[model samples]
Target: MSKRVLLPEDPRWMPFCKRYAGNIERFAIEVVGITPSYQQMELFGSVSPSRSRTSVASGHGTGKTAGIAVIVLWHQLCYPMSVTLLTANDMDQLKATVWKEIGISHERIRRGRHGWIAEHLEILADASCRIKGFEAIWFTESKTANEKTANKMAGRHGEWLLVIADEASTLPDAVLTTLSGALTEQHNRMLLTSQFTRNAGFFYRTQNELSIENGGEWNNLRFSSFDSPFVSDSSLKELWDQYDDDERNVRLLGISPQDSSKHMMNRKVAEAMYRRGRIIKDNENYGWLVLVDIASGEGLRDKSACILARVIGYGDMGPDARRVEMVKVPLLTNKIRSNTFAGYVSDNGAELSNVTYVIDSGGLGINVCQDLEDMNKVVHRVNWGNPCFKNINKDRYLNLRAQAMHQAARAAKDGRLSILTGDYRNQMLDQSARIPKTFTDKGRIRVPPKGATEWDGMGSPDLWDAVCFAFLEDVSYIVSGEIGMGGLVNSAADTALKRTEEMFSDV
Candidate 1:
């Protein structure tokens, strides 16, 4: 019988042995037959014996899980009996994704005739057993992952130990504390990575606040979908079309979404809330509602526009959501009379009976509202002269215009409103956002008549206010199937508040 020799014949036979242990990307390509793109290689380059801790913030589908799997195998096989602890925000995440990748590496290496595959790795322990989390020959798993898993960082010695915390956003500062103490070993490694979902906490601090460039602890690297060769251009475009600029930037470019200071109805929210299809389905469906902002003056003075919107969804979908949507917007013009406006709305997109009309009762809308009501076309008047707030927040708004606009802004901030993408979309967003507000003598928020002047060609944010009228006035019809007029909504306080809430509801 031939004796089993642990050593290989030549350098070419086992290239992994020739490569440095920290070269994770090389091991992935050479041994596992998996090639990482240039960006992935940069991530591997950041890993080294000298760099004890490394934190990576990455966008979606940048092969983070695959890279993680490669590193685990390389750390365990090359370092020889070194324990690699894997953890995440949740155990399901670890098991379904990171652990699955680990299993894939084990299977790939075994099939590829690599010496690393010669070793057997069975579950040495699990939560079902005496141990709380899973543990194998060169691995440990914990997802309750708080102080209990932090305790595992100690007592193990003999080989270089590596602690890999996946989705480090939720991994407590306690784990870092444990890692700090366990670094007594000369070759210990700690790797933390996650999608940049949060701009606070230890992950944020490690990645942004205290970076290696600033001579801080941990080598930090950020990878976007654009950086990864795995994501194709077509897929990138699809993502861009699907999400708002801020969301797409964060998801595809590894950029922070935004700080707190932004318009209530910013571009980020408009793009995000927008859906592909124009159709509204389900029981919540309300036929198109037309909102008319009457020109403050006749002929080229106050630009008049009518917005057609529908309730695609109803109620507070989340802590931050808007159930209303603007479907179509007609061109702006000067001095559209109530008769012409009524005829324009009925003929533009929706039929007379099938549609609901909410006309701004402020400005020079009294005649327009009276004309639309005379036409017997389900006209609901929105009195902007009333408090900007409604229901619970009535006291906080100077007038209904301010209330409607500010409410719409909150929806934008929370990613609750959706408007179709079009040339008018930009104009509408610009108008909605540009309306400056201030606290009145009575401590009420007031969006004054600033933009409807000669400076901006008397641009009254007509379409924007029309859109607001849809939410403040038309949405009540969607919820209760009723028509209302004057200052207050015709429905109960909860009904009006249900359509939209106060900006500072808690306050």
Candidate 2:
């Protein structure tokens, strides 16, 4: 067998050897308690050229951020005067997370005194390198770092520029469009890093499009927490055990998790509930009933929702039983006019007399309640205080709504709560399951997705709110001993038919 001799200073092998030596050294020594496997090193060395658009998705703490930091530092170090843009959904996040990592890497290189680099939120490289400068833009941190701001930064003069998007899921389509437009003028590259989420928005859509476009042009890189050398098998298993199948698929396996809000409840649970039995008719033994209304303005984005619940049965199986058997009714509005809303409530109430109406006395509903009172209807206005203003009370609309929502979530998760189980209910529950959680500026939680405005607007959550209120009100009546068991069977069927007729009746 012939033996191959290695030379200490072979210039023929210098370029290839040096190209990967830095990454290998860093990985072996500085990465702490972890060593890069051959596969990891291969991926680390295969950085895309300046003009390519690439995306990297991985489970949490799998070295995605570290890899990205290395990429930014390497590009800046190797390609002189290269101007790269490091960006995220917001400025604070970009600086605090991504830029902080880059800064740490720069200090490790000990090249600060060379005068070749200027560092801050934006970095400028001197004329020694072919690239011009590097700008750090955050989309969500600063209101100013919006689509227009991203476009302006991207439009800067450079032979080649790099745009890095961290936490790419939170980025808006506008920013993506702006960045894409800005890259058109030069040999630019885009890199996005985020964990995979379900088939809802930009990340999923972009991944799909990239997979389809030109037979998948953009390079896709993926890693998982389980794949991390630093993570022990036991640790990974513990993490895996912490999440449900859906969460594990998205957060650990790097597969997009299914959206939970598309359906109001779990499909299996709803199906099981459906198989139990049909709702029986209403009996006269049931006690007093109540209808509660919560209204938003008349805009297509905000409307009103009404919930009807009653007391039935006796003792533990009495009124509470009926509460458990509460049914939801969907109210129609011609134009959100007060009289129209009043007419809607009266029509619903007439079908089931002796029902105590708890109408919202806020926004448009305030006027509607007044109209109902003027008509001598037995409606009591509920002053469900305004959701606006600072330091709002804890029991206000949003918080109360949140509390009720949590209750429903628990019930659904526990397989103990079942709604109408009809096709409409099933559809609503499915939609609810798919709805993504969004945080409002006021620190309230909301789920807003496309095409969710018609079901009382406010996204698809309006229907959910109605269901929650119905459940709460019904439970309240039952706990208050307003009805008994016999009332439950009879009232359930009566309420179901009444709601059905009201929904199908010609106005």
Candidate 3:
């Protein structure tokens, strides 16, 4: 500072203040090797005393992180006692990409001049000279950010505060406003940058609303694939050719899909089926189809599901109930092994050996199927990826998995699927929503591998798979009695039982 008595305002530091301090683009270009594109420069220039809100919704490989890392170092080095808070979407992404760039910039700073304060997750700061041997406040914050962590970014105050939020599309509106509160201090700045994947969040609002409204207090920058020279021509071409236009627009050009219908079923239809499912007949005459969904990984990593359903033919039910045609009732759902499954069924009310079991003989299911077969619980062993059965026409569906899901979706669409009211209804709906469909090169309907795509905490639809398993038309029910939670385990043998009256009488 010019007025500081302890610190000297040297000529060497004066030039940096005059030019680079006012311009983050210059500071990034000269100090660190991070070259900013024209779009990046616009975003950097937006942060000032009057106009403080700055956001960039960008595509992949646009050097968004590199641009952000520049301003983080620029704010720390230029202003004494200034605070910089950095965060990203996830822990792995923060460590591997965003923070890694900041680390790079920290290493590039002239070692002698900038007194570094590195403590928080991955933070770097330039400390001012101590006043009367007391340490001057050098503020910097970092976190592997999430919905919870983003909300905790309060109580930080400084002469100048800089908050860099990377991968901010998934960020809730509260985070953006909460982080913006830190910028109330004079000369404070907030840079929000992301690859725009989601269209209905704080990111979407800034790109749409703030960009149009008497737009003086905001800076909105949009970057696409063509804007970045760092990405090669061949790479762009390959990506364009490989992915469909909608996917390429989101992945490469940073555009959110406006039309979500092609990817998923109608929410109202699914919600209706969840709320009101018309049943033809409610008795055990419907027959049973037991589905064994074997999980692979150990501990909480692997998720196993078993769905017991009762199926009734379309013609068997009354007129109103017949609208659903084939009524499938999910009687019991559990995660249990094949060997003990008979006991589990008996405890639930169905005789295990008599019930028809349809084992999913894919992946870890092969061994599970073998274990069940050795116990003689096998009715049908189905490979999920195989072609559709004769009962369900194979032409429209890509595979058995696709066929089952589509049939379930159609039932959901028509509000025809009868699901009994239970605690698992909302969870089932969420898992169903997570199912994203895409078309193969041969025009076949395809769903991406589980855990690859996630939205709103919907990861790996194990429960939805249980529901889908019951949709197989050819699956039969061999049990004579109805399945319900109607029995308790009685482990004692008749020969081992002693009369309690005789023992009490002797006493």
TM-score of each: 0.53, 0.53, 0.53
Off by over 4 Å in 3: 1-11, 48-51, 111-136, 144-152, 212-216, 261-367, 370-507
- The residue-level lDDT of candidate 1 at 272 comes to 57
Candidate 1 TM-score versus the reference: 0.53
The sequence of per-residue lDDT tens digits that candidate 2 reaches over residues 421-502 is: 3535644455445434433222133334345552333343455555544333223332222223334423455566888999
Cα lDDT for residue 32, candidate 1: 73
Q: Candidate 3 local accuracy as lDDT?
A: 0.58
- In candidate 3, which residue pairs clash? 288-477
Q: Distance (Å) between predicted and true CA of 26, model 1?
A: 2.8
Error of 1 at 378 (Å): 20
Q: Write the candidate numbers in order of decreasing lDDT.
A: 1, 3, 2
Write model 3 residue lDDT over 377-458, tens digit each, in one string: 6457777677777632353356778766766775565455656555466666766766776533222445666655533334
lDDT of each: 0.61, 0.50, 0.58
lDDT of 1 by residue, 69-111 (tens): 7777677656554576676657665676777777777678777
On TM-score, who's better, 1 or 2? 2
| lDDT value, candidate 1, whole model | 0.61
Give the 10-residue window scoring lowest on summed lDDT in candidate 2: 133-142
Give the Cα error of residue 149 in candidate 1, in Å: 3.8
